[model samples]
Target chain A: MHNLEAILAMGLVTLLCRATPFIFFMKRKPPAVLDFVQRYIPPMIMTILVLNSFKGLRFGLAPFGLPEIASALAVAALQLWRRNALISIVGGTGLYMLLIRVL
Target chain B: MHSNSEAPRVKVLGPAFTASIPVLLGYSTIGIAFGLLVVKAGLPWFLSPVMSIVIYAGAAQFMAIALLAAGTDIVQMAILTLVINARHMVYGLSLLDRFAVCRRWKGYLIYALTDETYGLLTTVSPPEGARSESFYAAVSALDESYWVAGSLVGAVIGGLVPTEYTKGLDFALTALFVVLLVEQIRSIRRIEPYAIATAATVLAFVLFGPANLLVIAILASIAGILAFRRRLP
Candidate 1:
């Protein structure tokens, strides 16, 4: 069985991530350094996460991880065209699901 | 005067609930998928709801199922959770002015700022005569309730399903993050952050393999950007 205490600890950590800025910034503005970080941190993080999702794909293997790469490109294209997050996500996930089944 | 105050509060919630419908749909399905993964990892079915109610970070909680099942230590799990949810802290940066008017409700708003909630909260304005405090709280609470309810339902569904049936459920996470990335890229026309993130991640992955590379990439990207901030937009 997974440790329930550990799960709760994870919960505490998440709450900390979500809450610390509010507590710290309540009385005063965030420092200039933080302001700079905030401006650039988000896009950087999102970009890394997108690449990180494709962490380990053996190029020589069958299916060759085509499903992940294809679906990601498709999702990006659909998002760029439709500009709707829900549509892009659902459509791309649907495509990925289909590809996994067929390939 | 109390009765007069309560009426707009009621009207306030109507739009907040309406605005949250999209999150309702997204969270319910994604939340169910998340709950199923937790159960698949051999936890008791009800633990899904508990985690959903408490941890509530979409990808972080999903990652937890794997890390916990693998018997990873608390410090690693803690750091992993922090790294995955780090972007959330900045969502509050944008909300400083929006949430400043709130008193009692601000705590709840801060606690519930998930990616979906933050996206919605930032785009929409409050309805006429509706206090921003109640409006924001209603959006946050409604989105959270969808997640909690979906987890309960997904847990029950997880109990009934065969393991193979949920095979592609994890793709939903990849799809969600990619969608967010695309949105971020589109919103900001600058190419520097994208270039920095790509270079840092590729360097880290090559140097350290897949294990804990994100933390390194994030740190590298942060320092990289700060040093070059003057030259780039």
Candidate 2:
């Protein structure tokens, strides 16, 4: 019910956002500064997004604790190890889950 | 338009495939986390990766989840997502000249103009006298494939994970970006963008909060870098 409606809304939003880039830039690439942006923005944004994810850092869904610290450490470690996106993700998630469940 | 027979598709294909291995591995895991998080948030099973594949924009997906979790309206969600992803306008314009020559591949290339793909293609000049169009096509397709494949993997993992266990996994995206930036820094001699970006990020975060920080940071960095470049020579 609520979930389904949200999904539909998300789906619609996703479609339009994803397609917007293609439509605007069709057969027309901008200059070098823009090119630099296409390269650099993601990494910068990712840093912010990741940090924000842990902003309210909590355990049992409320306040600062072990799980966030552990997951952050795991993500940093895995990222350094292979620089492989999938591995970093799985490794981080797996470690987070293990910590939450066992520790 | 160059006929299909003249395109050196394989030459471009090889590098695209080789380069994407790291991307595939990274994106799949990221996708998996996305899947687990969105599903954990109580979204439908089918929509998680569908958004990934269709939208194929990671940050936008995260925003979508946040907005959905709060029961925000469709129009608001849609507009916010658009504002967030509006940076692609810059990416598209940068590739205007290169794409102009790629007639047959243009339509599909336009469809797949993601951040990662644009990053790789814009930096690498095609081999002398080789088909630049083909190279662009190969890189574009390969990058999109990594994203699509990663999303599917995430969807699969989300389907299996329980909601209570989904915490802290979100940091994976952060770690992933750190790794990527470090990698980019290694190849780059240009430190101005890095410096400008760091400064802009700090400024934007303080001024605008995290919501519009990335866009503001990028715009500022671009201006700073351009000004600095004029002083270079």
lDDT of 1 by residue, B182-213 (tens): 77777777888889989999999999889767
How far residue A44's Cα lies from its native spot in candidate 2, in Å, is: 9.6
Per-residue C-alpha lDDT of model 2 across residues A1-103, encoded as one tens digit per residue? 6545554565555445444555666657555665655554444433433444544444465334676676667666775677664566567667666776776
Number of backbone-clashing residue pairs for each candidate, in the order shown = 0, 14
Top candidate when judged by DockQ against the true structure: 1
Cα displacement (Å) at residue A33, model 1: 3.4
For model 1 the TM-score comes to 0.75
Estimated TM-score per prediction? Answer: 0.75, 0.63
Residues forming the 10-long window of minimal summed lDDT in candidate 2 chain B:
B168-177
lDDT of 1 by residue, A9-85 (tens): 88888888787778788788677776676677667877887788788777689899999999988888998899776
Which residue pairs show backbone clashes in model 1?
none
lDDT score at residue B209, model 1, on the 0-100 scale: 87
